[model samples]
Target: MPEHHSGRARRIPPTLAAGLISLLAVLALLVTLPGTATAGGVKRPVHPDRDWMGVTIRAHEDGAGPSAAAQLTASVEGVDVSSHNGSVSWSSLWNSGVRFAYAKATEGTSYTNPYFTQQYNGSYDRGMIRGAYHFALPDNSSGTSQANYFADHGGGWSRDGRTLPGVLDMEYNPYGDTCYDMSASELVRWIGDFVDQYRYRTGRDAVIYTSTTWWKKCTGNNGGFGSVNPLWIPRYSSSAGELPYGWDFHTIWQYTDSGPTVGDHNRFNGSLSRLQALANG
Candidate 1:
């Protein structure tokens, strides 16, 4: 694996790195609490049994403890993780107010997250609405090939009303070639190819994940993909800023990379029921 592949959560400019460090300590504590309980009757795990990166991700969500004040701002709060999170305690996350999760599945058609099975299965076993995502590397491979690989590995969708459509994470290129060295039209074409393959395989559109700057530069504010894929916008600051060309509203907003108790906090822009509808697709 290339040393630059640090997963989707850390894909950000160096200038903003210092500002985000303060939140890392707090965010890593999401599943590191010695003892605590959430407001909705979910408690911490008593005997943790999950493992990642040599860490034990135990759960204690007994649904019987003094509830702590919920700090999640959105109607639906969740986390997206890769190997960086290391042995996640899925049940504890649900007990701690995480309603959904998007785990890193495959990247550039060849790289599949080693923890994909554990994270995906753990979230589902714990009753959290779970989905898988693929990291786009347009510079390295065809989008269709990557999409097919993603589905075959872990990004496949179901009508179980709990699996969210797969996400196409095409943002700041982690491996040097930002925009994947593609022209505006070529970038749009690559994304279209990805969306088509994902839709054909899953019978649902893939959510498009990208930052405003990347979208502007690569797609030239292209709205061609608006009808097929909903936008999953990422902004680290307090505000979401301007969105891409097509959508008047975003389906999902990645509000922050570091949460008070987790990494990469995300919000579904609708009520819980509405979120379930999207999941049910």
Candidate 2:
């Protein structure tokens, strides 16, 4: 009655408005944090650090390999690193007896490691046989496209003794479904596409990096790749235990994630000369 009636929004108290803004900010941050829930209620990390080689396997599988002490005694020791390792010290790794390395080069079809040159070349400069690996994301793009992306980046190989064939790191999906929503047959086809394209591009058969559990679950233990692609099997146990269906032996066995100086440690399942033979090929 006192004032002419006109609808107007009321202003909130300063303290309440500030609190509301702070809460909203926190919610936004949580959405992007690693392992936080995203679309479809899947905990996917928005950042690439969580896409490293063994991250999914470590998150999903459980096994204790031989003691790190026992595995460290192998003569042909190596390490695998990604951006998750930042700028690694290759000299320290070489001094610590790391003779070979694999660095993350690309992922999916869009993402390339920011530190690829540093890690890939640094290892070679330090006299370590080095290669690049591509982390597969089948659902996002076709395997041939992803392989082209990888080869165009640092994934190309040479017959020099210091360069190893590029690696295809196929494992559990870190972003969403374990198999990237692809059935076993679909995954096998995708892998076939990738390896075929990679071979066509690089002139060397790409090495296959996968865990036995993942190999069996995602590819139905596909035996077709064993004859052509070298297998790099991850097993944190005393033995690589029965390998996937086709392979009778593992080419490179990643024995422990908690390596001494820097990255995950692996043992070449052969002598140093044999390791050179692989690189030479």
| Candidate topping TM-score | 2
Clashes of 2: 5
Write down the TM-score for model 1.
0.73
lDDT of each: 0.72, 0.85
Worst 10 residues of 2 by lDDT: 37-46
lDDT per residue as tens, model 1, 7-54: 567567876776688578677765455223344432332322121110
Give the distance in Å from residue 13's predicted Cα in candidate 1 to where it truly belongs: 51
- Which candidate ranks first by lDDT, i.e. highest? 2
Candidate 2: regions farther than 4 A off: 1-45, 65-75
Task: Provide the lDDT at 91 for model 2.
Answer: 88
Give the clashing pairs for model 2.
65-236, 65-237, 65-238, 66-237, 66-238
Clashes of each: 8, 5
